[model samples]
Each structure stands twice: as structure tokens, then as C-alpha cells.
Target: MCNNQLTITNPRYLKYARITGNPVHVYSGRDDYRLRVPCGHCDDCLKRRQQQWFSRAHHLMKRMALRPDQCLFCTFTLKPSVYEQAKEKPYIPIRQFLDRLRKHPRFREKDPITKRYRYRKVKFPYLFVVEFADGKTAAKRGRVSTHRMHYHAILFGCPLYWWQVRDLWQGDVVDEAKGWYTGMGKAEVDPLESESGVRYVLKYMTKDCAAHQYISDVDARKNGKLIVSHGFGRLSKEDIKIMRKNMLRGASSWFCHFINNYRYSIPRYWKTACFSPNEIRCRNDSLIPGILRDFVKKRYPFPDFTFQQQQQIYNCLLWP
Candidate 1:
């Protein structure tokens, strides 16, 4: 006889996968239109974390009052060719393009108004942010497959023409015959709209959240990388990296805090039930029996909630 009580204390854990009739405790949470099993490493959890960073970044842009009318939104893509198609990690060229953009005189120039005199040049120190999204398109018959490494970038500074931006990326190359020079591929530029439009631009980057895809795709890890920024209150490369690390650490701490303050009580029907650690592993399907599932469903309408809500409910002695 299993004498272990199954109790749920953490709201972060949405559901338990049922592997046996060992009487496991499970919680149901709504993610989008369907119920999701939320583990710390699940795709939904990762997407939520990434969205937090995106929201923070958006807030920072608003605080700075970055005018989108003066900004440029550009998409940089790698060209399709025999040599380009042969590469495994296609995003390597995208990284090189970003490095070149960082070192480019046009990008590094910070003189706000250097063109005042005849001997001066126009200076535009601005913020440059880029997000990576999968461009992996399926190849039809007689077509070659490529990773389609690309980036969507927002340049919060002087306006630039489409051809000018393309040429600048092209100028990064020294050898035209090696095909490395042609990797600049296609570059598209357009004048940015309002703040809401900026969000729309970033929307594509967060579309499909596939944990396995992220691990295998070369472009996935570059989603939040800051390409270049030269102006007042600019973050250096190291600072950006540190800030990202801190953000992830902060998320982990939130879960830990919740876990520390969590207290679980056994229900009346399962007064003697307790779960062993070795038997608490994830499995498919529901661990809750039909009767208990109906009982819990009638009591708690939703199982998913934030840590703060969990703390509030605990303080109020609310459990279902």
C-alpha cells in the first residue's frame, strides 16, 4: 500500500505526468488555448522568461523616448549559393556582419552634429538592437536547403536608405571570389513606426517556442544580443552580457523563493498520502484519478498562477 500523501505547494509546477497508479498530485494550468504542464525547463517556461526580457527591453526604449520615425528597421539575410548552402552553422556569417557593423565608421560615429562646418561630417550616435528568428524554410524539389540565417534589427538613430545599408554590409567583405563577400545576401530597410509598431517587429522573434529547435538552431541563442550602441547611457558588450545573466538568475531566484515559502497540506481523503522523491518523476497523461480530478476541478477553476498569487493565497489560507 502507498501511504504517501500528494500535495502541491508550488504554482510554478502546473501538472504532473502520470506513469503509474502511485497516487500522484497534479495541477492543471492554462497556457494559451490549452492546458500546459509547466516544468522549469519546458518550452512554455522558456518563452515566458524570454518575454520578460523583451518587455523590459521595450520599457527601456520607451524611457529613452526613442523616436521610431527617425529609426530604421532592417532585415539582414544570408545569400543562397553552393558554398553558403554547404555550411552547417549558417548564422556564422550573420555574426560576422554584426561585428563589422560594430566596427564600421558610420555605426561608431558619435558626433551628434559634426556636419556644422564644411570640414565636418554628420555624426549620429545611436542605439542598435537585433533579435534572431528561425528562417529555416523547407526546400522544394531541385532546391538546396540552407539554415537561412537572418536577423531583424532596429536602429534608433539617423535614417538610412535600403541600398546604403546593403552596401555597408557588402563593404565588410574583402574577397568577392571566395563567396564570403556575397554572404551579405539581401538587406531590407524601412522607416520605423510608433512604439506599438516596434512591438510588432519583435513579435516574429517570439512566435514558435521549441526547446529542441533552440538547442539545434544556430540563430536561437542570438535573440537578445545587443549589436551596437554608441550614445548617452549606452551599455557595453560585457555589461549587456552581465545583465542577461542577471535576468536569468533573477528568474531562478523567484522560483526558489516560492519553493522555500511553500507549505503543503494533505486533503481529507488522502490524509496519509505522501510522495516519495524517487517516484515523483515526469510521465505522460494525468496522475489524478477520475473522482479526484472531478472533485479538484469543481473546487479550483484554474491551476496556473504566479508566485505572488501563491503567497497571497497561502496567507489567506486558500487551497483547493
Candidate 2:
């Protein structure tokens, strides 16, 4: 009988042939596959990563039985102060604002009726996705144009109003504030009760990479740039390290075995063929008893032959 090598083709064989490789097909279900392939953090790769994160978020929310109204969807935009407008990098203040929102969301308010002091805070268990723009695109006639950097976040277990949420970032500053009160930069909050809102918040995630406007361009060390958050589907630094450890790199023997085990489950879109070697090497075949070899061939005569023929036929089809 033919050995395991005759099953699916190795990725190196296709790479050496200089053929355009298909996306890495990760089977998620009986007929569902996720296309995940690295592309130097380009538009396509960034988009795939966003989709992966969104899927994780969706699943986590579903698993937690979170109702749409239980979550608060909001956008926090940075306003240009007189001091911030003249700076070369206006995103610095924006980053500082986000840091304050994530870490220290405490603010003080005095009750007009009772003349009592009250301090409140918006703490963790939140999800925020950030996007940046120069506002040259959103500007209209008679409208002021300025640098725009903001975040689209989902707050869990907090029912703060739009204005109250705005105050958390733009309130009295003798205490501490991250934003301005001119309403130039607004915080729009809405109740997320449907799947459409989730999609809307995540839709523009990878568009920055497409336009080459990475948050890293503003500040290389800034956190909460791409997809950052706490609670629910939050992937921490340690989680990322574990994931990286489990990730398979380039093609290897284990990869071939993986392909073989899932041969029947492989999606048709996945390219699976080998190319002829430039310098073929001869090796002795393994010794098998004549009776056993005949029995094996009789039982599995077509197992390996079909895949070998498939590779040969595909190569022929590629030739002009």
C-alpha cells in the first residue's frame, strides 16, 4: 500500500512552483471554514483579523446571554483645544483621553438640591474599538475641518445616559477630565438591541489599515488602538501568547498529517496539489513481506493513487 506522503500536497511544493496559494482553510464546522492567512498586516489581513475578533465577540456575547439593551454602544470623539490644535501630532491628547477613560473614569458632581458631593466612576468590563481620521473626508461646506480620532465602545453593566457618559470624559477638570465641554467632540450613546449595531461598530475597524492610517502612526506605544477591552471575549496579552504558541507556522510534516486527517473535509477552494521536483532523489523503498504487501495492495489499491493522479492532473491543467 502507498504511504502517507501520497495524500495532500505540501505547501512548500506549491510555493516552490510559484503558484498563488489559497488562504489557510480552518474548518470550523461541517461545511464552514475560516480563511486566515497572513499578508504583512495589509488591508486583507487586517480585515480577516477584525472578522475573527468580531466572531469572538459575537460568540462571547451570545454565551453570556447578554441582551442588546443590556449593553451600551457609544462613540467618544476628541476635540481640538487651543493648545492641541497647534500641535503637529494632535492624536497625543486623544490617546491620553482614551487612557483616562479606560483606567480612571472617576468624576465628581454636586447635587443642586441637596448641596451634597457625589463621585462616580465608569469602570472595566467594557469593549472599545478605535478608528482615526483626519476629518478632511467628513468635512462639509461651512463646517470646520480638524483631526478626528475616536473610539466605538460597548459598555457592559453600565446604564449611563449620553450626557452623563459625555461628562465622564469632559466633566470638571480641577478633578480630572479627558475631553472638552464645547460639544465639538460628542459622545453618542445608544442601546444595542440588535445584531446590526454590533456589525456597525465593527465595520470600520480594518479600514484604517486599508488607508494606511494605523494608530501606531500616531503613537507607536499606544494601547487600545486596534481592538482592546475587558471582560467577555477579551484576549489579553497572555491569551495572545498562548494562541501564538499554538499557531502553526509554515508547512511541515505535521501540516501534511493535518491535511490528510481532514482530506475529506477540506473546502474545494483550498488549493491542494504538488509540483515536480527540480532534482529528483532516488531512495530505496521500505521492505515488506510479499504476502503482506499483496494483501495491503488488494485492500487499499485506490487510496493513494487517486491523490497522486489528482496532483499530476492539476499540474497538467496549469501548463499552457
Candidate 3:
């Protein structure tokens, strides 16, 4: 089994909740929601963390580790609803800026393609904040580069990485196209359609619980379900079924769904740091794709890989 536990040994985790009637309200950041007993949220919060629950318990614990939610891939913040609404209402960010553009004598669209594109009305549609059920969205990131995951690509759109690389934010995607990145990982995107007529790509990051990264479609008429990656490590199909069943039972809000969605991606990133004696063996053995394997060579110390390992990397990047 993979070790997906979050640490919470500090009494600090307990403080995350405020006791209320039968349902405990597990609170984090500025949000609160209902949960049942064994209330892992509560247990991790109050009970001294048992050497785990560290990251899950409190962002403060990391001291050095910035909150994962702050990262672009985790894009827990940013409201696409607001931005879209402003566009719909003709509410420009600055009246003067709009006026200047409007006054230009030849203001009509010149490009036939641009003019052919008709606009649609989207209320409270900031751009993309994962389509909240309640119509509420989080604050947008101050800068495009710093936008969190959901907010990152929402403003642009989720490519779902039809390519070999993954980008945390829309701003970063351009750079990726130009061959600039820390490293690239690929995975097939499974679109989990929700009742709300929306679809989300769920996957766990290397060091985070599941996070909602992409929303493929949305229809206001239906409720939505989260789309998560297929499997992780060596779990048998039965194990995955059991875990999914348990996860659904304990799930409370969209947050739980986020974890449920990407639960598989987390452990797969864990490597022993060294699996071969000689450098060539190690480089050839890495899970990175042959296309990307060149990366390990001049990019970083080569990690070993075999033909089978190369195929495995390809399978992951090309996941559905």
C-alpha cells in the first residue's frame, strides 16, 4: 500500500475544528464544512499527530514549506465567475481604458476569424473557479504566474496536457511550449462528469492530497462528480475499490473529492533516489519517457530505465 497519510502530531490540528452539535465543522483556511465521527479532520487537528498528518494538519508546521494550495496546480483560490460576469456586464476593469478603446475610429473587428467568433453570456463566470455549486468562487490570484492550480488554467483553459509536459498555471504553459520547465510528467486525464454538468480532472501532486486541476465541461442542469486518476502503486483492483468506497463514505465536501480524485499521483512520484549501481543504469531505469529520458541525461543525473520502464512512463503521460 502507498503511504498517503498527512501528518498532524501537533495539538494544532485539533484547533482546526470548532465543536458543534452532532456534525463537526472541520475548518481550514477560511472555509468550514460538516463531517462525521472518527472525524479524521478533527482527530488530526486535536490529537497529537502520530508522526503523520503533518502536512494535512497545519500549513504552519512546514514553516518552510509553502502551503500547497498556494501553488498554481492546487489553485484553491481565484474566481473565474467574477471575471466572466464583468465581461458579460460590460464592466471593464477601468472605465477610462474602455473609453480609450471605444474612441478609436476604426474599432470594429478587422480579422474575419475574430469577428466570426460569437460571444456567449456567462453569469458570475469569472473565467474558471471549478464551477462552484453554490455559485460562489474564491479570490483570483494577483498575478497570472502566481495563480493557484484551478485558478491557474481556469483563466485560460485546461489542456489536460495532450502533450508530454504538465503545467501548473496558464502563464507557465507558454514557457513549457518553449522548452522551459523544472521537469515534465504526463498522465491521461480522466474526465469525471458531475451532476452540475461539469467535469474535473482529479489527481494527487507529489506532496499534496488530491487537488482539482481541470474542469472540462459544465452544464448548470446537473450536479457534478470529480474525475480522478485510475490507480497508484501496486494496489490490486479490489484494493482500489475498497479505498474508493471508504473515501466516498468519509467524504464531506469538494475538498474531500479533490483528495479522492488525485490520490494515485502522490505515491507514484516517490522514487528511492537511487535504484542502480552505475549512473547509466539509474538513468535508464527512471519512469521518465524515452522522449523525456534525454532530460535525465543532460538535464539531471541519469536515472536508470529499461524498455519496459520507458513504456510505463508513456502510459502514465498518455493516461485517460
Best TM-score among the predictions, by candidate number: 2
* Per-model TM-score versus the true fold: 0.41, 0.46, 0.17
Candidate that beats the other on TM-score, 1 or 3, i.e. the better one: 1
**Which 10 consecutive positions of candidate 1 have the poorest summed lDDT?**
266-275
Q: Report the lDDT tens digits of candidate 1 across residue range 1-320.
A: 11222343444342233344332243333232232234533444444544443444453465456666666677765555532442455445555654555554544434567644222233343333334333344444445544444556666664355556676665556566764654466567777776555555555444334532543455444443343343423444564454444433532321111212432221211111122233222110123233344444454445565556545554443222
Can you rank all candidates by lDDT, best first?
Answer: 2, 1, 3
The digit string of per-residue lDDT tens for model 3 on 16-90 reads 333332222234332213222232222222222211221121212132233322222223222343345433332
Residue 202, candidate 1: alpha-carbon lDDT: 51
Q: What order do candidates take by TM-score, descending?
A: 2, 1, 3
Better-scoring candidate (lDDT), 1 or 3: 1
Candidate 2, RMSD to the unseen true structure: 15.6
CA lDDT of each prediction against the hidden true structure:
0.45, 0.48, 0.27
Relative to the true structure, candidate 3 reaches a TM of 0.17
